[model samples]
Target: MNGKVLLVEDDASIATVIRSALEDEGFAVDRCESIAARDRALASDRYDVMLTDVMLADGDGIASIDSVRAACPQMPLIVLSAQNTLDTAVRASDTGAFEYFPKPFDLDDLVRAVVQAGGSGDKRGEEAEAGDGLPLVGRSQAMQAVYRMITRVLRNDLTVLVLGESGTGKELVAEAIHQLGHRKSGPFVAVNAAAIPADLIESELFGHEKGAFTGAIAQAIGKFEQANGGTLFLDEIGDMPIEAQTRLLRALQSGRIRRVGGRQEIAVDVRIIAATNRDLKPMIAAGQFREDLYYRLNVVPIVLPPLRDRVEDIEALAKHFLGLAAREGLPERRIDRPALALLEQQPWRGNVRELQNAVYRLALMARDDVIDAGTVTAVLGDPAEAVMRGRDDALGAALAAWLGDNAPAHGTLYHRAVSAFERPLFEYALGQTGGNQLRAAKLLGINRNTLRKRLGELQINADSFARAE
Candidate 1:
């Protein structure tokens, strides 16, 4: 808080606000309007941190950072930009800025970042070569945080854990890290742990030697070896078997692995990027997922926001998918603004993957080059009905699975099913309302007394859903 700060921004209003906030926090602040002034200040005096806006009156702030870094290489740099795109985030990262705050950012968060930056030394590292075909796309504020997190890990091999609901493009995040990172030249290997049988997951990851098991006709290389000098993306990591988790943990810890039955430990030079749709914390508490392994993999957790949360990005994402479909031999199509509006209103329960599929379907089946709301409805059906259909399908499948697995006594089946359905429904309401009984009851469209009675019968601790501030 007592560190000297050099603030470079062209707009007097913004500069004043930032300078005043820093001064209030006990920081000595110097104001500058352009990159030239920023450079002059750097030469005249040493500042603990430099907070600069991207666009200046004379030249681009981020582009001129090389000169600033050369003059004061040890000083931590924090970038402020109104250009809140993924490209901008990557550029700030390339300059080795301590943090990048997109314009319209929280003032308190910026002050807090400055406080953290003051105590830190230089974070400048080798600049990551920017790639044109960036896999992930979204300029929304929610996506800015994700883009920043992605850039932070591009120059390093820190183990990353991508968490999101299914179809939220978790693999795309893994791909972006690999493609934009230093490992771009090497192979990018991905394995879905959930798709693979639990028995074969270990062999799939660490390989197996000849005669290791009944099916081992010859020695085979595993994903770790295949992705040597690059990245190994373990998708659906939450579904991996307990035994495989142990082996994975050992390999991650030691930087080496052994064949299923081999005596020699083969060294691997691979970056581990794991992703899962499941909440690992709950799994850890339930003793299903290993706590130690969770900690090892959660070093740099990147939580991808669900589609419902980033509705603003729906238009861009839909257009992106349409372009992809066109390149893949499907008929090109453009969605009109009205159609896009309809899309943004729908609760995309299945997230981006589902949207992509819907787009591809529209591209293939649209009557005209321009997709209208009627065309969308014709191809995808009414948005509300689609959501209900998805939920009904999922519920039917879940009920089928439950009945197949647990065939209760004839008289108790109805009671058991009602309890099963009501418990999760009430829990979801409570969770959404943060355990406020009145709010939860309103959310569920039920009486508070009825909710209380049901909670008592279900033995659910409503207080557990209330998050600590």
Candidate 2:
């Protein structure tokens, strides 16, 4: 047998399909229908991996995850759940299951997880702390999977590959990981592989000695060198040239780099967090990106949800942006309930970034302090008649709109809104003043102590914002 599989599933049809697939792949699969049967099998035999369903006929598969680990401490357990809720996904990560597959999962994908689990860590993985205040906010089931994936890699130095559509906040995720990780004190150097000319990509990443080439009049540190103690965010990595990819792969493999036209090898201790809006597998097939490099950067992968998939978060995100626009010296404005409803109904192909820009534009264009549905529809370019369509019916629109898709959580939403708005507001202010806190405060017309309080409350490190602002 290539490897042993302990399959715990009560559904006969699903179990038969899984067993057939594993058996075809040369895995010796022992199928059990209940927790008692699973326990008995584990007691009598050893297995390389375990695949357990979340809802077993005789047990709750999601809750049984930890107990399964107790029975076979070294076995990597994969959770398959029909529940497929946000809570279920979080529980799977909490229990340190190697992977969580929702019901109706692709057989091939489940097989891949089982095979991959052969080399995964044995100990129940650490649960990612949610203390950073959920920077990537969306309680949607899709976002839940993303959050779980993000938590899995927080404490490790694993190279992360974040995949998402344009303006989906890929860089934000990278920044969060760096800020939350051990390298918070180090610099974060960002390089856009797509933006740089192909000719300059090498020097941009690997540095160049004086007289290395034309315009190389002085020795300059590259992104890799500057990020030696921290993270190097490589955005649009799928656009990298094949030649640069080769050098990057070699540098990553050896943990050292030789500057252009220089013989000295400099050792670098930097973690890589890369993002791409493009699907790299297709690029690899086209001979554009290197396969080995993809594996290296994708040691752990996270995919962000598009705005359409998590529209419920739009209201909160909109309110936060509205507050930000005000802080940016735009006229202070409040979004009325109907305006929020009207905002939610649009097709936001541009995702969160589009929504933010729209809100800012609305703030600038709205004629009154209270922005109503008419303004939102007008800004969204709906029919002119739809403007102020329900201005008289604004009372229940926003709350009812939110209630339709989102179950309000306990506690006041006010603090979270303030925390979300102030961090970026201060960061932008500080960045504007070259990280001089006093100057930033002066620019914002606030006392330095008050600025300090917001930063402390939000767990934001002022030093990190120094360059970013």
Candidate 3:
């Protein structure tokens, strides 16, 4: 059989787009527009693979997977959906789908999976072979630096502190560390400090006894316990509550944790991997974060440069994301030179995450064989016109507003707008500076003590900043 694929999608436009892409790749693409058509295709065809959307106009896509499996037991199936919840991804995996890509997936990932389907390390292959490294599609020097750090951390159990912008794949770096590290056998337990409610974070990190709180009906295991002997990825660690920070500091100091409602301390042997978009030194200086814990977690820091800083990787990354999207049944898509040039020109404030989103949007909306600059402009909305022309209809109005109103006619807009962007930068720089007030202030261009006052206002590193320089 010639790498046949069964694609079930309700949207004819999307299906047609996907078919063209796959056909170009030499796959005998079979499109089924509805559940009935899907059933008919399955009955008549023996496909090497199946790409199914999570929702069909006639019924549930998850339900259809079982039918596909019953029909083609050995076929590799990939589920494409907009749902991003862990439960949804887990359920798709549980149903025996080879992979579950959240909607807006890059097309490169899909193609890679197809290429690796019968080879070693395919998505559903054995645990030792199924490495979950970040789908960081690039070979640029910046990416090489990131890959080096990941490889280094994976060789052993080193406490890693990853610093990056919000959408720069900090969590992916942490997971890659786990997948590549000596402790790959253990579960990668991720806890987003900022996402958890302040009152519940402690209990979440350290399991509570049954009846510890109003909803505690059964004994619960905290993230520390779950990640025992594996990796504990604390995302947005800068946002961890002060009380929890104190507790976490003690836990890291002693390798033992006291459950929220229990008196006894349980020892855990977990490799800590923390990440944050914010700076920690300022938080430590302001006394919002514990100083002692900062040093403990800062053993090895991996800083991820934002997408704008590494513009060399745009074309490769965009094509990679587009390929993943197509395999997930969006539409077979290709970025023309003009579209790629426009992508390279954008100021990626949200970093790689934003670019992936834009490409996915373009793939869905673009109407022909190629995605040109017009399609990119339509989906990404022209930033220059949006910003410089003050066109409110432009999608990049915010960027335009910042550039036109604040940027002076001198150096680059980045240098001029650095102060306005100081919040995220200050938070990160201070953490990098280890909470020294005089040092943090000097780095940020304020007086040594003036930096201290701002840390207080932002509830950042007051103690670290207050330290003797």
Candidate 4:
């Protein structure tokens, strides 16, 4: 509180309000309206912290920070911006700013950040270049919280637990952290706990040795080893078996893993980013999931808002999906205002993924270049029906159809049904990965040899799915 702060903002009212707040906290404030004045002031006096607006009278405040750093390299910098997009937030973080406050931010939070920055000394580092075409979309206030939380963890390797309903883009948040953080140069390995069979979960994570178990033909690396020096994204962590959870907690605690049937413990350097659609509290109470594991992963929790809660973002999200669909070889189509309104009114129980699918359907089925309300209704079905047609209903109908069409003998039904579902599943994975066995195995949370064996047994010619390099 007994430090000097430089304020570089052009708005008189905002400047006055901030000045009053800072002075009331027992700090001396120096005000400047332009980058030129800021540089001049920094050249003359040393301050503990500098609070600057991104847009200034003379130039972009964030862009002009080189001169400020040259003038007072030790001062902690705080960025305030009205442009509340993810790009802007990342730009501010790329500057190594102590904190970034979007427009209409809480005044008390700003003051506390200033106080912390003033006492923390220098917070700058080698600025990481922000990547282009970031995956996350939407700029609603609800999303602002998500963006800010994402920026806070880029500079560190803290464990992040992303919680949200299915299809809420939890993995996207994890990907953003890895792509934008210091680990961008390293490999990003992902595994879904719920997708793998319970017996294989540990081997899928910590690897296995040759002859470790039945059909363990050769030594294989695990997700941990593959993600060394980078990030390991554990999706659906809540569904991991209790025994695997204990091993996972141990690995997190010791930073080491013992391969199955191996005597020596191998050390791994990887950042963990876990996400789940299930609430762990109930599972913990029931002793289904370990309480200790929950706390270890919950070091930094980021809760994603469901799409139904953030209705304002539907239009932007819908348009984004439309663009993506067109780029992916779908017919190009734009939604009319009425169509967009219809989209916003539905309860997107499946969140962003459902909306993206709906948009793709609309793009493919629309007769006219411009999609209207009638087309939306026709292509996606009535809003009420769409809401009722959740994932369970679709799966149930598919199962019923399969059962009716192929009435296998009672004892053989399970095997036949599993093979029926897995054929298309394996094909889809191969198609998505351009027939790269290694990548498809990762996508499906199974071993590479297993995928190859399944493909051969199912008479799937993987070469047909291969893309021209």
Candidate 5:
């Protein structure tokens, strides 16, 4: 076949016209009236492009595009819509639509689209690379999985749900999807659901009329409307309010939304890619989230692993951050082997963001060109004495636990009383230094004289607590 096309439409007249036009252009066309038929055609044969209507008598047209893209990631999709609204176009585009045509569109226009699709070369090949000149970073298996998924989803627009911890680069993943997908030319509009106030989320997403609320001084375009002919990234989606979820679901389902306090429904063309750190499944179970909304947004789920779990990539990530910092004018910063080792050894509870902050701090504070383990400890470790004190406390607790189990209540009251005073004294000093007694005393809301007296009475040594500064 010179060009193979999957022409899906419920109206026989429309399908017949499209199929005839395609065949006349020396293309082989397969026609399907329903999603099931479309799937059968998809499974049995390969096509260069798929022409689908927005509404099917049997199932949704956009949903069908998602299903087809799942099996054939690189197949181009052109949406045919009678609705002819920006919302319909945006929705179509978001699902990786190659182009959209309104009802009564000329057959020549479609043929031109088909010809363009063919000229673009093989539809099945070419892993979608990022368009922003920033390639996906990280060599971890988790990042590799993300890379594969990004390639799969690049050819088509499928509502993508990116799940990851804070600072795990969810926005980067979303940007990659938009850059690699069919709508590469379209804009990427990112919105943080959690950042918007509860009262303004709806307006932020779906726009507002001039008089929608007290603060509505002018007619404002929402992220969805602005993202027409592009991608809309909703970050921290799990933090989105239930009321906003309902509105979002309605927009997703109907491909239309009324501006806040507006009577008319405005159309918007956009692709929705949402990211969140929280688990939406349990939220659904707890009735904090809607099950239907979850299903709609979760058509393509990509989970990003925390940095600690992908320890193999830590050094690479550190280098990447350090290079970035250097370019940003922090040229004096350079991590040595010992510093990298220290980074690798420490638990990264805060993930990538925390690491980025640490690198920035190193760049800002390093006394020499090469950042050593001591500098790493100075910037990252709890004030030296605090870390030591914390370690000592852990040891003391272990010993106490062993003694309690083996030796029992013998002289326990005096020892317990001693522990109580000693623990507070150490904790106070630690808190003062940020756990350094010299620094701690200044901050203890106390004079050094008083702090010294208390430490003496409690039998606590300040020098032993000093971090290896």
Candidate 6:
């Protein structure tokens, strides 16, 4: 771990602090205030490790990293930068940097990375082939593909659409993209499309001018304005209102917006990433979703696998949750081999989120510190059987009854049955989302305007569903 260090940084204070910390660990430090000085130091000295900042006084550190690598092919290079974008992180990764640390980074992490860089040890997020910095937690091929896709989108601002079931961590993927992209230094604003009320979704996304509505007290910034120069993550985007979808599509195409009551158009620069659990094709066919908007958002689609598909990764995910539980002072705990095996065999209807909830519950409720099969069995109760039964008994019966009744019908009867089934389903979704047209639309995998039109056709009143108990 002890070796000679070359530090390339423009900031004098940061260099001195880093040098002092490295010196405390019995390593000789050669500090360079600029990339030019760095080249001289690298040529003259055979250092064990070299650290360079992305933004340097003379030239860009990232640009110089390639030359440094060529000169010192065997030497490990650590990149430090205040630029802190997904673009920087990915560039450093692509250049084969031993480590990439964003500015205001933890001093201890730097020391540990330095020691590891000087040595041949593998870090938590590193494998022989894949060298990601974030602890995404799964080592399965499913996750490897995910990592590759995420890394691909990190360098650019291409709109990304993350498709995954709930609790599969779609937002985390969005966050990773934002953190690794050129906009890393900018704000990352996230809004759940299904959580906002339909009436307010317009104003929420695009700020309203004062007196635009009865409640307009002052001019407020919307998600687009707030996320200027960064990324806007729209969770459950399939739920966005149809009317709002029109406005959003305009903004995405023109990169400009006009407030609710204001005439002045404001330009914005923001990356858009959207996620949804529901299938959207049927909604599009049903005239509840816009085909053009779907095409725009689906520019770069990444589908996250459900937990059941990658059973090999269950133990790692469970242990990660357990580790989190232990850190939160839930009394030290560990899952036994049998318990882990049992988890991998589960149906995992709720996917990773369900597993996390179950693991945390087991960690807290287990009689012994080491959780065994009995504890997992007792906690999960019936291995998601009840959930399957609930769905089969109700919906399965309904489907069976419809098929039996419609078997004699001729000439493509799917349309008739679908029409019969959709009315109640739409009503239920509207109720569940508390009549929030946007959320209900999202829940139905359609657009808000579509939901509103449907309501009028069916004469469904949403005001009573404003809140659900």
How high is each candidate's TM-score?
0.83, 0.57, 0.56, 0.79, 0.57, 0.60
Report the candidate with higher lDDT, 4 versus 5. 4
lDDT of each: 0.91, 0.82, 0.76, 0.91, 0.79, 0.82
- Please write out the lDDT profile of model 3 over residues 1-469, one tens digit for every residue: 2478888877777777777777777788888867788878889877777788888888888866567667777777777776543334544654556666665566777666654552322234222222443455555556655654554444456688999898998887787667645687888899999999999999999989988889999989999999998999999999999989999988998999988889898999999999999889988888888888888898999999898788878998899888888988899888889889888888777789988898888889999869999888888788676444443445366557767655566667666565566567677667767766667777778786666666666676555534365
CA RMSD for every model?
Answer: 6.7, 22.2, 18.6, 17.8, 18.5, 18.9
- The global Cα lDDT (0 to 1) of model 4 is 0.91
Candidate 3 vs candidate 4, lDDT winner: 4
Preferred candidate (TM-score higher): 5 or 6: 6
| Candidate closer to the true structure by TM-score (higher is better), 1 or 5 | 1
- As for TM-score, the candidate ahead, 1 or 6, is 1
In candidate 2, how many clashes are counted? 3
**How many residue pairs clash in each candidate at the backbone level?**
0, 3, 41, 0, 14, 9
Candidate 5: regions farther than 4 A off: 1-132, 382-469
Give me candidate 3's TM-score against the actual structure.
0.56
Q: Name the runs in model 1 displaced over 4 angstroms.
A: 43-45, 390-406, 415-469
TM-score, model 2 to reference: 0.57
The candidate maximizing TM-score is 1
Name the regions of candidate 3 deviating beyond 4 angstroms.
Answer: 1-134, 386-469
- Identify the runs in model 2 with alpha carbons over 4 angstroms from their true place: 1-134, 383-469
| Candidate 1 lDDT, 125-215, residue by residue in tens | 8888677878887878889989989998999999999999999999999998888889999999999999998888889998999999998
* Model 1: how far residue 394 lies from native, Å: 7.6
